[model samples]
Target: MKSALGKKKPLELEDNVCRRTNVFKLRGNVPNYLEESGSTAAFQPDGWGYKSHWGMAVNVYSTSITQETMSRHDIIAWVNDILALNYTKVEQLCSGAAYCQFMDMLFPGCISLKKVKFQAKLEHEYIHNFKLLQASFKRMNVDKVIPVEKLVKGRFQDNLDFIQWFKKFFDANYDGKEYDPVEARQGQDALPPPDPGEQIFNLPKKSHHANSPTAGAAKSSPASKPGSTPSRPSSAKKAAPSSSASKSDKDLETQVIQLSEQVHSLKLALEGVEKERDFYFGKLREIELLCQEHGGENNDLVNRLMEVLYASEEHVSSSLIKSMNSPSSRRSTDSPSVSDNFRFV
Candidate 1:
């Protein structure tokens, strides 16, 4: 059994890895096998043909295999390879723990122990695996160093487009059984028809005299009937006086109410006007008192000035008259007659 299994080709393991990578791609998630670049190769015991710890062993043979030596280019190449794999096959190969472990190994310190513990709380933690992987990448600032868009090159965009298309297609095609018009009509038709005799019994019957001309004439001329005419008019005439009286009383009440309201409004307005007039009248009286006091003072000053002027004029007139009468007598006064005589006649 050991000899037969030992003869198994290395191509078989490569094929398995390829198939696994394809499965991971379908799930829109990163595969673990890509991170196996630095992992140790399977070491078989002497008696056993197959290696017990095949996943743990790192291959030292490959030149670009070491995790420490692996650069951004190497990581990008791994991502591209994963993206290129068949999506359905990759889904079959991927596991949450394996993917987590791969990311933890690839980025070294990016995924913390706390994050791993948080995963236990989730229902279907694998669904969140991509987000965790992106978080890990972001933590290391891997997007800045080697942009994810350049590496993936529209893979995420393509997936999103596919999802949108699928959703639209599903909604457009969806038809509920309850809402089908044909089914509803069929259900209505399936109900049994009602009995004609029962329908006739349910209908209202016409009276024998319904179509009679006399019955129609009687109904049409009800007001023209001898007994009905006098009673109707008498009752109507009696009701009219009472109705007219009631209407007249209502109108008078309404008019009285309106007049009262108008009177009340006018009284209020008049009171306001009177208050304003009183206020202004008080102010006018105060102004009149002030004018009277100032007028008295002015009159006293004018009278005093007039007395002084009159006294001065009288004293000057008296002195002039006295001088004229006394000096040179009539001779000095007659000397002024020369100037008077020289005046043009």
Candidate 2:
């Protein structure tokens, strides 16, 4: 077994790998060998062999030989028909021929004796081929023939170019845009720049009427024109007969009396209203204090009211009995009820 790692440039000699297995016997579509592009190699009656320019008896798997099953005449005929050359032309056109030339130089005394066979399970067969190639290259010691990194990077770039080309074509067709070879992309244009004064809308401006001095001065005047003459008072006087003057004086006196009476009545009414308001205000304050004393709970007022009602039941009953014993339940016009003093509570 050979190591995938720690082999000096094993990956470079990929073409030199070979494989042979019984499962790939030449019958039906079964392949006996494969070419560089993974196509099956044709078989011939003459058994396959490999020989260097300087001959050496080196045994190799059947897969290593390019003509796995072809007869010598068959190979010669193939070369003559396709390339119009003899065995030399066929050897030249062979996929690994260039690398083999280097290998022959590197291993002057080594050459394949038996051909390597390709199997139906060709993927596994290729792995076997890679192992054989690494072994052969190691035996030949052809370190300078190829560089693995350069080959790998070249293949990677090829795959990337194909992917990018396909992606660009797809994007252009999907988005309905003209394809640009240089950019290899298609999309909408970038957003435009905003207006310079766009931020001014965010702030509120003061009204001109509110800030002007003339507006304030106009408000103070009572419909007067600016810089105009003011009105004057009358100065003429007139006299009347004594009797008529006396009658006018009597009428004025009566009007004054009536006005005085109205003023007195209004004053009394205002005083009564003020007293009533004070009484109710004091009662509301007392109720508030009572509520506070009872831990600020409104239900406590209901309980207190029930207790007062229970305690006053006897007194109310006695008052009812006395009223029944009296001559009248109605109040006389001379002695009014306490409510009559200020009835509008």
Candidate 3:
């Protein structure tokens, strides 16, 4: 379970177990399994970090393997032999996650290599470059190797600067077949003029009409006639009236079209307003019906209250009459009663 690195590590155990499991699974269904995971190193235009590079490397290796007409077993075997590792490590290295991490010196987002199908083809260049990187790591020690952030910053700028320099160098030293500027210019100039039809179409309508030979001939025809000078002014005056009439007709037509469009739009707006009005009216009717129902209930409640008040008044009047007619009341009223009796007699 030990890695090429001398020290024992937890990752080594986990990596080994994963690799073994994957290898056993690969034997069960080679094409199916690989197809399911092969795209792990597939190119992703938006990817950053080691995954992008790993994908590029995989693409390059895929092309080589396709050219060589290698089979899956041949590729796997080649990977194992080149890296001095077992089939499990080879499989893991071909996988998108491990491939990127192994090359980039840091783990990146999970990527599926399923689409790559022949991911093992990437093993050659991957192992070669990885070995070189590992050699540097051994010399520097893992702890002393550049931190991921610093490495990214330093390498990114360095690569950019190198790319710029390379571009400048290539531009300066490039000696491809030189094109003659004079010949190119002459060739362009010698090109046939644009078609007359195209030129006519490109001209303003009025200008095009004025430039027509037929129009010039027609204008000259009357002038060419002998003794036509005296009648020219009259003819022009007549033509002027006709032209003005035609222009007025066009203006009227445009006004009619505009008015018609306005009418149509106004009609649509009126219909919409009517619909809204009807909707509100319907709501108002519902409210009125509700009010009528409530009014009936209120009237019943008022009638009940009035009947109770009338009954209460009648009971009080009867009670007062009875008290007045009682025997004790008659004695208290004896003088007034005797005077009343003498008057009656």
Best TM-score among the predictions, by candidate number: 3
lDDT of 1 by residue, 1-345 (tens): 122324632122322232221111111111232233332433222211221132221111122222233333443344224223222221121222223334444334555433432223222233234335445543443221212222122233333332233223222222222233223222322111122113222223555356444355447653646655465667775565566656655775686678678767766776675466455535534553454346547677654543332233346478658857986545745466422432221
Model 2, 149-183: lDDT tens digits are 12222243432332233222222112232323112
Off by over 4 Å in 3: 1-230, 299-345
Candidate 2 contains a number of clashing pairs equal to 12
* Candidate 2 regions with alpha-carbon error over 4 angstroms: 1-241, 295-341
Worst 10 residues of 1 by lDDT: 21-30
**Stretch of 10 with least lDDT, candidate 3:** 18-27
Ten-residue segment with the worst summed lDDT in candidate 2? 113-122
TM-score of 1: 0.20
Query: Is candidate 2 or 3 superior in TM-score?
Result: 3
Model 3 lDDT, residue 239, Cα? 78
Cα displacement (Å) at residue 93, model 1: 99
The lDDT per prediction is 0.35, 0.36, 0.34
Provide backbone clash counts, one per model: 15, 12, 10
What's the best-to-worst order under lDDT? Answer: 2, 1, 3
